[model samples]
Target chain A: MNLHEYQAKELFARYGLPVLPGQVAQTPEEARDIAAALGGTVVIKAQVLVGGRGKAGGVKLAHGPDEAYDRARDILALTIKGLPVRKVLVARAAEIARELYLAILLDRSRKLPLIMLSAAGGVDIEEVARTAPHRIVRRHIPLEGLRPYQARALLKPLFREGSQLTQAADILMKLWRAYSEGDCSLAEINPLAVTPEGKVLALDAKVILDDNADVRHREWEIWRDPDEETLGQRVAREKGLSYVKLDGDIGCVVNGAGLAMATMDLIKHYGGEPANFLDIGGSSNPEKVTAALRIITGESRVRAILFNIFGGITRCDDVANGIVQSLKQSPLPIPLVIRLTGTNEEQARKILSENGLSATTSMDEGVRAVIAKAQEVTA
Target chain B: MSIFIDKSTRLVVQGITGRDGAFHTGQMVAYGTKVVAGVTPGKGGEKLQGVPVFDGVAEAVAATRANASVIYVPAVFAADAIFEAADAGVGLIVCITEGLPVRDTLAAYHHVAALRSRNGTGRPRLVGPNCPGLISPGLSKVGILPGHICKPGPVGVVSRSGTLTYEVVQQLTHAGLGQSTCLGIGGDPVIGTNFIDALEAFAADPRTEGIVLIGEIGGSDEEEAAQFIKRHVRKPVVAFIAGQTAPPGKRMGHAGAIISGGTGTAAEKMAAFEAVGVPVANIPSEIPSLMAEAMGRRRPRSNRAAAGKARRARAASRPRPAARDRARPAAKRARARARKPARRAVARAAGGRGRR
Candidate 1:
């Protein structure tokens, strides 16, 4: 749900905010073409979702088209934070008189959108929060959203000139529109720069859309970065399961988000590392379990697969049936341990036993068994 | 006995006639919940599972005097459904719908808050936009929680996750500890109820002798709850937090279960609880014993042993289908019971530390 700098800028531009003209280029030639068109000193930024791109040498400033092409080539060849640079944003660089930070994000504690403004910008906000806590000012937006007067009041400390304050407030209002209308969890402008000519421009943009609001904004589907998704994640998403890959040997499939996390924690507590976190969700549709197994088993690093199901709305029998049916289709090479309890648990145990498999009802017992089995496989 | 719903809860189902709504409504009715009405805008004047259906929440409330409403409507209409339920004067609103936009939840939450300020006496309590709802064991079931996993007793349970609540509740039940009420406050970033709200209720309720709080990596609700427990709650409280191994910035299934910007980590929450003198359980199964220790700590020195004996007796009297269903021999069960003291000793040793 994270948008690249270019994408965020594009969204910002659509709201008539003062964003530098930028173009995304996948190749050096395209980068040259964009740099030539902009006809000024340009910044070539790697289009990756992770932070610290500049520190990783993925961002470079170029004086002309030739330099822009060379910078883009270097960036495109680099892998920053394990993600290969697939695209670069070629934008006209700004001449900043001063830099400021502006953002509106959903504050979980307040259960409302919060506008955060700071005099410090172009660096990690968290670092600023830790070191100079007084620099940042935060105001919670009401259900009606960020009002124009509220935006001006929030920005007044950062801006000295009345015209500049009004201009910045207008931009803040536009950013709020983009955040609320586009259903964004976060919309940030780092280094809201005031040029020597006294015009304000957003040097960088980062926007994270709320995935839960996808129903309202189906058009946002085009913005999804397929490159960011692992094959397992993609398949899991298609199967209506939540799966996150981790570097471990014990693959865990559990019901509910909290239980999935708890299952992972228990695996680690028992001295075993979990390869993935998979939640089949509340409805115990047998197909989801089958899909979950297929995804987990697809990871060759997994030495053992553990199923921890505590059924509530989810019936344990459906999960057992899914496991049985999956094993029948293609047997697992890795060891499988299941701990089933709660609703329809007896029926689930019966189904597993009929298939020459048995499940423990105790989470501790099951976690211990799986860790032992995984260790055996390693040994 | 319960903090929220009990035998007096007259429930109404919103989006009744829909698949999930109809299905869970039938389950609630089967669990002895007094489901007085159903609300479906177009499918009114019909009976679903012998419950009368009405055109809207207002009509349903007027006709049946349904004091509580559970919504299973789709995410698009969920916010309006909350507004309707609140406007219709339902005192307790439990929304089971998931994937509601945060904006909608915020609006609904503020609307309810505004109503609370305007009309302080009968303002409604909203449980969740994405939760399994709550159950008062043997008295009433409101949402989708499986009632059989619970039993009527002195313990009160509140959690952020659904099946995780069941996991801990089943452990408590197997340990011969039943619950007064078990509630899931939902895992969305914005929810109607929070840990402090539920903890305060449990602290005030006389029937709730001990409290088990199941929290995960998310907002500082658990940390705030820990503070609330330290300042307000005198009851024995045991806490368990999930997502100890979860990496930062990844939503671990639940939309809200993410460790963002070096905050909302499980370790932080656990530390908060430990600082507040709440026993933090390392695993879900360890919660019942931790609850026992917490409760035992509050009693007089001589009564501690007597309380332990009473808890063991209660556990022994319960039909332990969980152990028996493993198909283990009787001798193995006896050996497992014999090893309980050793496990308890280990748990006690690790009690001072939030994490090993």
Candidate 2:
């Protein structure tokens, strides 16, 4: 899950990280209250789960309470990248002496945590890498160990001279601890701004915790946002299936994540878009199928439903029964294509036919049938 | 001659008393896998499906001499199960459970790597903590991989897609090919046993003739595998990459499938495979046939071209029941109120939202 800047900062503050005092406000009056509490110039930023908010007029500097309210009013009502502003983060603006970038993320290739650092900060890191790849510095922390000194070494170039080097290294080491102990998949302190007074503050923060690690990281649970996706995905999650909403017409219900991806690819290859990625996983219970189909049909963009269950340990008969049960409950008006394989496939097909639902056994035939039905309906 | 599991590999079931554990164990045992023991805390000495259940992995390993382990534990405890099996010196670990915490996986992966490096031996090969697992027909099935569809043959398989593995096997079977072994490496962002890992094993296996590698858009797993193929693998590999036209910047299905900037795309994977001398098949249906042709099968020329043609023609020939199915009621309602102009009820069935 992705936590907004305010949410991440709040968690960082709770963990004793140096963070600027900030409050979230939904209206101008609330912004004024937040500014008055800070009693200084505050930065008003639009709360959206996207980047480049500043470039889009979603972030502004407010001189005082009056300016804070004006900026919040403008930003709170504006939309950035099609996501409406529901909240604005009002933070006390920091005096900058120097800026640096630091982040820790999983390197999939190495199967270990990687720490990324750079002297350049407060801009898109991708741009920096593209334009001047030499500036960005990265270090891999082996699974067997994490050395604080090694992490500090990655930021050695940023130290340059004077007392700033020790302070920067100290901050980097502390950030590494926060990255590891916090169970953060991504912990970034962009523009680790140095004030004229020479104190470091995490002027901006972005932290994404591993959702699966939520059990281990007890304090991070307050950052969970259940309202990110469509209701179907939330329902599917509750039912223990992996479902991600997509923008398309065909409702794809497949068995495995990889297969689900391939099925979606096939849908697109056939010029038919997939509406969602719903994987019932290895279980083929009728209830799970019922839940998956109900979630699919409940979707407004789904014109046709495709059931691609390559039953292995999951009996095909069980998948067929689930589809039958789901159809009985919802009475699918949209065209349905069922492709059942693996253990007891004949029995599965027999059950479907017996229930007056003849599903195609061929994947090509099943995908073709669903795509055609989708086009016919939309046409 | 199979890559990983064969008749000689003794298997142990972890979390044996659980519902999925029991169900899949029954299916695997019926499918001829030599399931010697089960491991569940406090369930030691109990018999499940005529197999002895042990209290721990060490006990199960010591008693049964089980070299292979299939874990069915929940996501919360999956990492511990893998670590337990890894610690117990199990030669092969197949984890069928999904939803392992990323942090746990990171720790487990590092531990496994360390053990592999520290022991002066390779890591006990892990298939998945979130995958469907692997099946070696007429050998030992060490996972919850659906074995009913697989039969013994000479074809080697490695895939990031679980369901696509079946699709490839079905086509291969229809084409008179049986797989020596099939591995579903899974599509989770973090997984055990990547394509390169399986490719190395399949390349060395004597029974395996050629390999069918199916990959999807996301991550550099496919690219790494392709590089390995170019560097070491001599086996003729047939590759099918998924999500060619997936919308830019939007995640198709896998969290790793998001196209950020320019790298890690299906097209890039295809190019990598092609550059590595691995024949890339764009259409899914063409996979088995391409492998068959690579194996020196006499296929009709028209059929091969038509398969590609059919994929294109299929774009426009998709079946639609909505118009005819829903129109029946609409036509009757229109006749009932012929005096008034018919106001079309906005089709809220599917593809209703996001219409321009």
Candidate 3:
């Protein structure tokens, strides 16, 4: 649910924050038109979902329309951190006499939205945190919005007492409004630059929306980035499966989120590494099992697959049938280990046995058997 | 010895007649829970699993006097269901629905907490928004935990994961150890009843001689529980945490099961448990023996039916990965304690019960 920089800036501008006017251009011709209209030096930023765009040579400055088109062409052809640049943002370049950092984020440890401001900007905050810890100022905003005085206090040391300070504080408040109203998990402006003309503007925008809060925020759908989602994730989402791929050799398919976690933990404990975290949820649809195996076996890193089902409301027979059906379509190269118990366990075992496969009832035994089989395959 | 419920405990089922509601309701009734009433708007007169249905929480409460409510409502209306149950004077509410929006949960938590403060008595204690509820095994059951896997015993179990809780409880039952009460506090980002709340109840319950805490990579609830054990708990405690190899920034299946800002890792949580004098188990199967060690006794030999499987599980046990406790080797010390088997549970029960 991460919003691209242009989209985040749009929300920022909508909330009355000072963000430079920008246009998204998918082609070099559009970039030329946007650059010509801005009339001054424009910044061409690659619109990819990854950070470190400057480090990756995706962001460049252009003085005129021709230069803007050339820069956009170069960026659009480049892939930064495994994501191809699809579009470029042409924005009016701002004159910066000083750069400051600001962000409002939900700190899980504090259970509060933290307002952070730093005198140092235009660099990784992790680096700043490591080098000089005292340069940053942070305050927790409890359910209530960040107050004016609190915002001023965090920004006071970064700027002198003047219109710049007042303007920065105002923008911070507006940013808070955008953050809460938009149900954002993170709202950040890396460089709140102070121009020579004494105007403070948000130079870069980063906003991460909370996916769980989408029940209320229907207007944010246009901000979804399909490239950010892996193919496995997209397929799982469409099939109503909750899956997050990992890097290991043992693949897991379990019912219930908690069970999926424990299955992974048990795999690690038994001297095996889990390749992914996949939860089919409470439904015992055979089709979900089929799709889950397809997703897991599709991974090149997976050496063996494990299915741990403690059927409560989920019927074991459906899962067994799904396993048999999937194997019939195309037999998986990796070995499969399944542990089925509870609610029609006998029927599930009979189905698996009839399909020339067997299931274990003990979780420890199942994990051990899978690890051994996976090891044999690797050897 | 059970902490939450027993035979006489009355229950109300919210979202009754729905898919999950009807299915789990049948399980609860079969498990001997006193399911007195159900609530589902427009399905008031319908009978579900022979339980009387009402339109709202207030009507259901007035007619049946259900002191506890377990909600199976979807995430959209789940928060209101909590408010409705609390407003109707139910003392205990268990929410089993997952995927509840965090904003809605925050509002529900505050509303329930505020009502308790204003009334000054009979405050409702909420279990979870994404949890498997609690079971006082062999007496009464609420929520979705399978009843047959557990047996009544002196061990009290509290966990954040439903399946891991079942895995550990089943292992304990297989090893001839029974739980006085087992509860899954849930894995959501913001849950109502934390590990501390469950630990506090277990500490006060006379039936619980030892406790097992199963935590995953998540919030600082496990660390707080370790601290609470140091200050107040007298019962022998054993702990296990999942997601040891979980990569940073990955969601790891649960909403709250992510390592954020270099904290909430399983290694840190295991260290916290060690610092507070509680034994830690590396895997779920080790939980029963660790709890036995904490209780200063040997695990009673399992029945003949499970003997072969138990032997195979023992044979499959392997050395765990690199110990995260670089200097202390705190978990190894816990294994050492298992060999000595000091009778702390007997001494504590005889030591005038250590003043609350």
How does residue A355 of candidate 2 score in lDDT?
A: 92
For model 2, residues A1-379, the per-residue Cα lDDT tens digits are 7789999888777667788889999889999999998988899998788888989999899999999999999998898998888899999888898788877777888877787887788888878889999888888887655666775566666766656666766666667677787777688888787778877678898877666667776766566556456688778868888776678889988887667777887888778888877778777777888888888778757889998877665678988888888778768778888887777888988898899988887777888899998888889
Q: Candidate 1 lDDT, tens digit per residue, B84-155?
A: 999999999999998998888989998987887788763689999899999999999989999988989888
Worst 10 residues of 1 chain B by lDDT: B347-356
DockQ of each: 0.68, 0.35, 0.39
Q: What would the TM-scores of all predictions be? A: 0.92, 0.87, 0.87
Instruction: Report per-candidate TM-score of chain A alone.
Output: 0.97, 0.94, 0.90
Q: What is the per-residue lDDT of model 3 for residues B122-159, given as tens digits with 9 covering 90 to 100?
A: 37888898899999999999999988889988899999
List candidate 3 stretches off by more than 4 Å: A25-30, A73-87, A107-111, A127-136, A144-162, B297-356
Candidate topping TM-score? 1
lDDT scores in order: 0.89, 0.79, 0.85
Residues A1-379, candidate 3: write the lDDT tens digits.
Answer: 6788999999899899999988999999999999999988999999887778999998999999999999999999999987889989999998898888899987654556788889898887767888998988888886656789888877787778579889999998999999888778789999889899999999999898777788787788777667667777878988988787877889999987767877888898889988998888877766787789888877548889999998766778988887888788878877999999877889999999998899999888999999999999989
DockQ of 2: 0.35
Docking level for model 1: medium
Write the number of the candidate with greater DockQ, choosing between 2 and 3: 3
